[model samples]
Target: MIVAVWTISAGTVMPAAADADPPFDYLKVMRAEQMWKVADGSGITVAVVDSGFKEVPGVRSESVLPGVSVMSPPINDPDKKYPAHDDVEGHGTSMTAVIVGDGTGGAPKGLAPGAKVMPVRTSLGTTMAFAAGTEGAQGIRYAADNRAKIINLSWGDYYARDKIRDAVKYAQDKGALIFTTMGNDGDANNSGNLITMIPGVLGVGALDETGEPMELSSHGPDTDLSGYGGKARIRCRENSAWCVRNGGTSYATALTSAAAALVWSAHPDWTATQVARVLIQTAGGPVDGAKRNDWVGYGVARPSKVLVDRAGEPGAPDGDPLASPAPVKAPAPSQTAAAAAAPAKAAEAGLPWQWPALGAVVAVGLGLGFMVTVKRRRG
Candidate 1:
């Protein structure tokens, strides 16, 4: 399959215009060099717990397994099924496209093109209320119980929920690797100040082309690694045939999820902890530089490093893999200010930002701009 590649320019930060490179050459490098040749996701099932999903060409259709819908003011039809997944606001489509999209019809390619995607519509916005009472915790439980090995949570809140935490723990016990964004608020948000729990979570940070942390990529206690989450020029959902650049930790989370699939697909016997360890141990870039800043976390993740590793050979049955450790020094009090204010993509407070047209979503079969409707799919 043809995949796009993205390369980081000289420094950690690039001009906004740099996001427009065609074919995303850097992404191609990662897929060609870092990605495993084997179909590692042969038996893996990933749950993309996010907003509304429209049946699209590149994304998994039948593999887009049915789950619960918690949309508020729901879509009125309960029995209707669309031919492709519609992207109401373009957020969910971009995310899922990066995970399991086939890149057909010039659509952006996904990291794990072969894996099954179980789309669960959560809350409409960034919260866990799009679909109603089905919260993040519920999504976790559903994926775990349904034999999903990987769970991708592309949304985040400043504080962790007890219900969500417990559900994550349960998923861990059942052998699921849960990957989530560390809140896209680094260059300007208060996510770092909040207490974070690392257990049962592989918190991911955002990395740019140069393999450095984006100014807005949040960093904190639980941040394990960074991924390509930047303003990138790719296919636009408005037309789905033109180019539109986008970036954020949301994209990074999806990339990381696909990375985990690569490792897990290669070594199905490894535990979630093991898969996480390999990522950390093999992460590329400057680990020492980020040691002082909680905002950047452990720097950008380079699966290529782990892919080429001769130390812990792939498929080796040995001691605990998660035990691979890298010593770090905490940041000074002055450095903590980086966590304040708005990151690059955070919607400006009260800015008159006209939202995108909701028509494309309907065309893709999302049933948008209609009354709330929930249809129960009986087993």
Candidate 2:
């Protein structure tokens, strides 16, 4: 969550196959593209809350929505114009590129190209990430209210702020599937990340090229899941042909969001609970056959197992096995309004809470026992 200080050393890799999109080893390893033939996350909108965003060539500008900036005074790039992009420090764009980029001219192709992105720009890298928490809180709420169901929060702070927690609750109530990193301090501290303290927010780790947990990926009971962490391609500018290879839970989180988008788009009627359940069920579990481990939680995502192999069952529509009972604690009285008003608003129409319809056909004969009637409803 905390990108203490960022220096964009985006070393561009050489171009390959100008006529075709270059292959991303992570995608192939995860088999994420296997679902594109049937479902490519066409109707899902994932909100990426981070530094800023700019649509590069492989990342379609049309698919990127006109998102809002939550900066206190609002950043104005006098060099350009109003909202060419909220801000572009390269990090946010990189995360966005990993989830939805189309892989044009050797650029990175996101896992879910058919899905749209709603960028929520905040002052993440320019200042203390704690300060961005205030803006990120609002950004989360805004994204939830504006048709974004799959929300990605790639960064986090060390402390849990009440406003952000409340916003997370608000978004989850609106059926938002929130994803965040488990922090890069695994080898250093092994302490829990800010995301672990929040309920209904998934804390994701990363996996290496060998499909094992990444060495730097944080672990523990709070680690919800894992995703591909091998080198991923990213482009900083739109017109540039150069791309950089990067890896981390940030892209892992993005890939998880893209996986959710793929499942959600394929079964539009499924609730957040159903999509999440299937993802966890279909994921590649530990090699030892253990149910779950602190290192990879339930294991790395294998959405292909569901869409391609016709595996994993979507459970109850309303049941969320990962849903925490209640994590929100005391908040300053001044901030009671957002939390107080949430239930009232959440009660409004959101994710449909209906059970699957069941039907059966039966044929009945009269007392005379005359046969010759076919029951059309029979299956």
Off by over 4 Å in 1: 1-23, 31-34, 60-63, 72-87, 126-134, 158-160, 192-198, 233-243, 285-293, 308-379
lDDT (0 to 1) per candidate: 0.52, 0.63
lDDT, residue 84, candidate 2: 22
Tens digits of lDDT, candidate 2, 1-379: 3443222222232433334333336666556656898799899999988877865566789878999877665346434332526554666777777778877755577888899999888777565454677778889999999979898887766544587788988887788888887655554555445654576677787765444455556666667677766565654444244344445677788888898898888889987777777777766553234455566666566677678777667767765545422111111123233323333222232211100010101111111112222111100
Worst 10 residues of 1 by lDDT: 355-364
Please give the lDDT score at residue 283 for candidate 1.
Answer: 52
For model 2, the stretches where C-alpha displacement exceeds 4 angstroms are 1-24, 74-84, 235-242, 323-379
Q: Model 2 lDDT vs. the true structure?
A: 0.63
Residue-level lDDT of model 1, residues 1-379, one tens digit each, is 1111111111233333323444244456464334556543556677876664666565657556665554443256656542224445445566667777766644566777777777766553433232322355677888898888888876664333566777877887787888777665554433431212435476666655433455566565556656776555333443243244545677777788887777777777877766766665555423223231243334445454445442234323333333434522222212122223224332222111100110000000011122222211111
Clashing residue pairs, backbone N/CA/C < 3 A, model 2 = 1-155, 1-156
Give one clash count per candidate, in the order shown. 36, 2
